[model samples]
Target: MSAATLLRDVFGFDGYRPGQQEIVEAVTTGKNTLAIMPTGGGKSLCFQLPALVRDGVTVVISPLIALMRDQVRGLKEAGVVAGALTSGNTEEETDEVWRNLENGTLKLLYMAPERLASNGAQRMLRQAGVSMIAVDEAHCVSQWGHDFRPDYLRIGDLRRDLDVPLAAFTATADEETRIEIVEKLFDGHAPTIFLQGFDRPNIHLAFAAKDGPRAQIINFANARKEQAGIVYCGTRAKTESLAKALRDARHSACHYHGGMDADDRRNVERRFQQEDGLIVCATIAFGMGIDKPDIRWVAHADLPKSIESYYQEIGRAGRDGAPAETLTLFGPDDIRYRRQQIDEGLAPPERRAADHGRLNALLGLAEALHCRRQNLLSYFGEDPAPCGNCDLCDKPADVFDGTTPVRMALSAALRTEERFGAGHLIDILLGNMTEKVAQRSHDQLPTFGVGKEYSRVQWQAIFRQIMGHDLMRPNAERHGALRMTPKARPILRDEATIDLRRDTIKSAKSGPKIKQMVSEEDAPLLSALKAKRRAFAEQLGGPAYIVFNDKTLIEMAEKRPKSLDDMARIGGVGTKKLDSYGAAFLAVINGEAAAQHPQRQKLAGRNDGSIYDRLLETQATLSRGPSGTDKPMSCSASQLAKVASQKPRDEAAITRLLGDRAADRFGAAFLDILRDA
Candidate 1:
């Protein structure tokens, strides 16, 4: 009956994660609470734990039926009594749930927000002994939220009618949604609020603007090989196409979308849930209810509708607090398509303007110079420090002064009557000899060749940066005509100089970087590990990396574990995996150990204690897991190799600085082994 007993017996986590205990304590004390946790941050436990500790059945109002079903199943899997009331249920199923509620056998009951609008459903809740109402996806009640659902507006009345304390939770909500949630869900009754920071530091965020997005996605996936991940596309057709392309490239991938038959969708979901390293190329429909937490990465082949949507979508990765990667490939077409959708929608002018503003925020994220993680959190009104985990923070961008070119482009738009789009303006700026330009006599305009200082591509980049700055707005009514805003008037008046990012043009002359080879000391061990993996994959009739990825193999060779337990402590070696392949990997490591002493003679002459100390420090840092992991020695192993060859202290350098993958596979406790060393 105690929280500790419930923690151990029901959920099975030995202790609460940070903020979980505080939230549970607050909710159990019968105070209204608003919990804003990042996705996979255990928002469910904040409510679920309190539900078990409460005296009466706790009613959970969720947005999606699929989400409700998944939550109930998960609760049952954890040996907690839970049920759901949805249209999919039979008469007998309804009776059984109600009977359990009446008999005090059900501790939690999940229902969609729409269910509260039904007369029959209202009657059941009116009679049922409900202690607390917990609203999931609580942001849906706020009209300002991206995923707002109209039915959620009815939930506020339930709080008054039921006269119970309420708790509402969402992974993402801007300041507007947070205020709206307080007003609509709790009737303006202030609740104890917890805004857990939004940064997922374990995720390495990268953005690539390029053509042939499908080819780019395939190449990225090829590097990852058999890692479990999701590829999100804007359309169902793109999802199917990309999935087919991935399959052709020899990856285990399947497509999912709302357009698919129910049976097929279910099958795809099952495969994605049960199998490791299976890629699911899907529309937004595939992720809302999915509870699979170890998704190694999430790639966006196209831009999402809003920053909120982007935040929620990418939040699906690194759920276990492990290192994961996110690569988003977007282009001008994506922006144009989204703009067209907004312009054509049937919303009020104010709402439409708000939507445009939200879209601009998303674009800001794509073009931001600072840390992507920091920018994302700032949009949600949470200012987090620059997370060194993202691509931008890891590698600083090259900024260029664009005041002259930006003014010239804006002048061209104004001189041409602001009737043309980016392509036409670009043509005029670059002194093109197109038929439209010749017919309109636009080549004679004073600003025609003013932007000739920059190349066509550089001019295009200037326009994009101008738009991103919100000094110029695209006239969606005229098929994206360039229109200057009041903000631009000052710039044209020479009040300010605009700075923009330099274009990163992919050169046709450049070749891809070759995959670097492991050091000679590690080569034999790496070969042995790969052979063992191939043999295991052959026995299992699956891809070689499915058993254990190259990342895992690299860690094994670097760490050189001495026992089955030590092998299990290597990254990516799960319990099921260690039992299956641990012995074979250990044997390879042992064989390599027996064969090695390559630098023994050289070590006798030199007293390089400082170098050894630094190596130990680098290993200690890498062993801490990704977010907390220290920067490895700034120099390369090959550089160290020139210094010493005894077991190659350079071998320590060759160790590939084990990433969060090791901590993930081996658990945080195993980091202690390296920490103590």
Candidate 2:
């Protein structure tokens, strides 16, 4: 079949996203290619579609077992024959995959690079008639990439042995990674490269100087209530603390990190996939290969490691092409912390310097006077015009002449023997009487108290802006000591005037106000619904979110659906759910309805025909032997209870309301049973 036919038949996408068609065509023509597309830019299909059209088996080398499993599952769901070999599989499972590969039943095989590092595995690949090698996260081969895997370095040997055209793909990479991939993976040969534009217009980018980051996150979450999202933090502790803070603020938030057990991570992933309005507060570990498309926003509670990491993390949002939002909260300390990490890392001196440069690019992003999106795209070699979507473009900054403060800060750094850090230098400028200052007695210098005209906070802000401007450098060895660069010398010598934008500190009061917009009576119903969800979650031994999300409950409370049809119309209630719990919830609604409006009491009995038996049989059949009753389907009993209590419905409504899973498993069968009844 043609590429377009394969695209429509297998993946169901009407056309290729930008750069996908070219990469697919390159691979189909048997040429080695390196494709660097942004996250959510359809990178997987560039190789997957070509694999289908190509003659031989396409061996995909991926980094994570979870990622491989997810891809395999998605391909299988789309009726494509795919399999993955990972440590998580049982012996029989591995045997089945191998059998399929040997018998030519599987078109694509995904295994980790570590698997290929074994000699026996390499022999197996040779015997399997491997046609081409597709490396996902190709940046891992580059020492310069944020997430470098040493095992990936061995793929170069695999490429030589296979002697087939190889295709490598990554969502984020810099010039250093591009060179490293070509050198290491393609054996020093340049491949057909495609660098797709890294702009995501659906995402509204904004940065907040770190002040009450938790409060700001809460405000943002509340404003966009009932949306699936992620909140990334630098530390595991921060993830836990911020998640707790969000939960305390009544947002349905959970924490995930590498420190958690694998089972817990799996649970988090499942919740993120199945539920809506869940805010996953996590480290970068949480989002490498997630495919959920409806995420509405991504927030950074701490600065990310690099610009590439930042882009990949935020690119998770707005995957469905809907307008989403991103918020990054950073402070000066984040820069210092990142600098210390780069300096202390085991990378060679030159690589360390490159890493530091990469971090500076991120700091530059945070401190840019122009559109943040514009600066970010420029770093990737794409010159996008001022995108009116970002915060800077939406609200133009006010520039201030910083000649006096800039000169004073630069001179103070020089006067302190150029040995002091920003804190000490700021103290010298403002003449603070701290112990370090008094001991230096160099607080006695001519520049001491010269900057008293500006407050200590103001001086600190000026120092950040100056460092961001590259007129100064922080000596990493000396613990981030502020030092005047050559760019600062002319300015301090009065030969050049420095103009800086007046730092725009978004007012704490500027966010949307949270009022009790719903009536006081509705508050009780909301609480009751949440309690019910918690009880159901406890009974099922799952997270509170796995039962029914607070957003769904809130919508139920707001709409007060009187019938099963109305309950199914509530945002998260599906057919299986309406069949199971619609009546229970409707009973509560009707109870409240009778109490509030006696005239509606007769209407409750008007739709009392028995529709519960057919739903129970369908549920029983779906839960039949070996599928395991313990492993609940997406719809839980309590969710069904809520639906049944809310609405009484026929099998047609049940199939319609339960969604695709119910429709697929029991639609026609249940319809036949309901007809007989």
Candidate 3:
């Protein structure tokens, strides 16, 4: 069958996503290839579709057992015969996969890289008529990568032993990691390289300085009620606590971390795959090969380790090309924590310094001025026009000339012999007269109180920005002390100037307001479609998106398709899904059926769903007057949601959003709920 025929008939995509066609063609044409497609960029199809065109079974070496199983399950669901041989497999599962492989019925055989170390494994692949080898998470082969696997080293030898063409894929690889992948996977041979654009334009980029972070995360999740999302935390313990917090806030949240038992982790993975709108609060341990395509949002409860890790984590959202949103929270402590982690690792000093540089790059991204998409793409060697989807592009950051303040902070660190951290340095700069400052005799220094013009908080922001610019960094050897790098000398000497975002200096106001995926008029229909999706998912025992993704559902809500034919024309609805779910979903769009799942039934007719129901009711109660005493006044539905989320503290804040008349009527009651909340 032609690739196009397989694409339409088997995979259901009318055409390839950007950069997929070339990689697919390269693999199918018997060329060794390396594709650096971002996460959820259809990397699996690059090899899976090519395996269909190839004559024999394609052996895929994946790093994670969960990843292998998920991919195999997804491929099988699409009518492709694919199986994984993992340690987690039961006896019957292994037998079924072996039978399919021996009979040449399986187009793809998935296995963890560790299996390559077995004495019989190479021989088995040779005898199994393997025509091509695909390496997923190819960066894992590199020792420099965050997720290095020693077993991946055997892949190059297997390629040579089998004498088969190989295709390598990774979402996060820098120049060094790419070189390591080529050296280790291709055995020093260059492959046909395709570094696709890393821009996930559909993901709205946002960042906020950490302030009441747990509340911030809860509010973000509350706004996106009944939508699947992931929250990445830096520590395993934090994941559990955050997950508990989310659950308390009435979200369907679960936690996953490496410290969990294997079965427990697997259960979380399974639930995340099968349940719709389920939030997974996880350490970086999760989300390597998750195939769920309809994740609506992702938020970082703590700073990620590096820029690549941040990109990979956020890339998990908006995979189905529907609009998605992301929020990252960072604090001064997170920077110190990450710096200490790098310094305490066993890596060489140069490597540790490089890691610090990588972290600084991410800090720069968080403090971005112009556009986040443009900033992210520039890191991966692409220079697209400013995508207006990111927070900065949507609402430009408030920036000011920060050269003088940065120089002052740098001067303070310099005069203090670069032995003081932000807290100490800020104390000296703002002339706090702390006991520690006096004990160290820092109050006697010339730079002491020089930055008194700026508050302690502003001084902290200046220092953070200085570090973000890589002009200075925390000295690990000195117990979290701030140290000036050579880059700072130029600024101190007045040879260079810097511009910093003023808003970040004065603590970020709140998370960025994200653009909605659909129009206000279509929101009810979208909710109805989601209700139908949940019913189908519960009945079929799989993720709601596996039946029809958010993109397809949004289109249904927008176009109001009335028949199976109209539904089948949607992007994600295939022949199988259309046959199974088309009529039910169409009934929802056409209002022919009111079969709202119980969970969704609770949210019916409520703006912004249940989390904000109390606030919405309060607004409605006060719509007329304090006691039905005046002409009717009301806030827009969106404004009510905003008030509920922002939880404004006083009448002034409420007045800014609503006019004086509406604020006077409802402002006191709104503040009462906000305070209680």
Of the two candidates 1 and 2, the one with more favorable lDDT, higher being better, is: 2
Residues 1-677, candidate 2: write the lDDT tens digits: 89999999989989877778888999989899999988888888988999999876889999876678788889999988888888877698788888888788788999989887789999988988889999999999988789999999988899899899999999888787899999999988899999888889999999888777789999999999899989999899999999999889888999999899888888888889888899999998888768888899999988998889999999999988899999999875566557656654545545755666677678778878888888899888888888889999988777777888888888887777776667678777887888778887866788888877766556666766786677776543332345566778789889998767675422212223336424332543454455556656778899977766778877887777876556766877775565555566666555432121122222232231233434555667675423555444444444344334445246557655667775556555555555654
Return the TM-score for candidate 1, rounded to 2 decimals: 0.70
Best-fitting candidate, measured by TM-score?
A: 2
- Candidate 3 residue spans exceeding 4 A from truth: 412-448, 475-489, 508-677
lDDT tens readout by residue for model 1, 311-386: 8889888899899999987676677557656654544445655776788777777777678888788888877888
The C-alpha local distance difference test score for the whole of candidate 3 amounts to 0.81
After aligning candidate 1 to the native by TM-score, how far in Å is the CA of 634 from where it should be?
Answer: 93
Model 2 sits at a Cα RMSD from the real structure of 26.7
In lDDT terms, how accurate is model 2? 0.77
- The models' CA-based lDDT, in order, is 0.75, 0.77, 0.81
Local error of candidate 2 at residue 461 (angstroms) = 1.8
Order of models, best lDDT first: 3, 2, 1
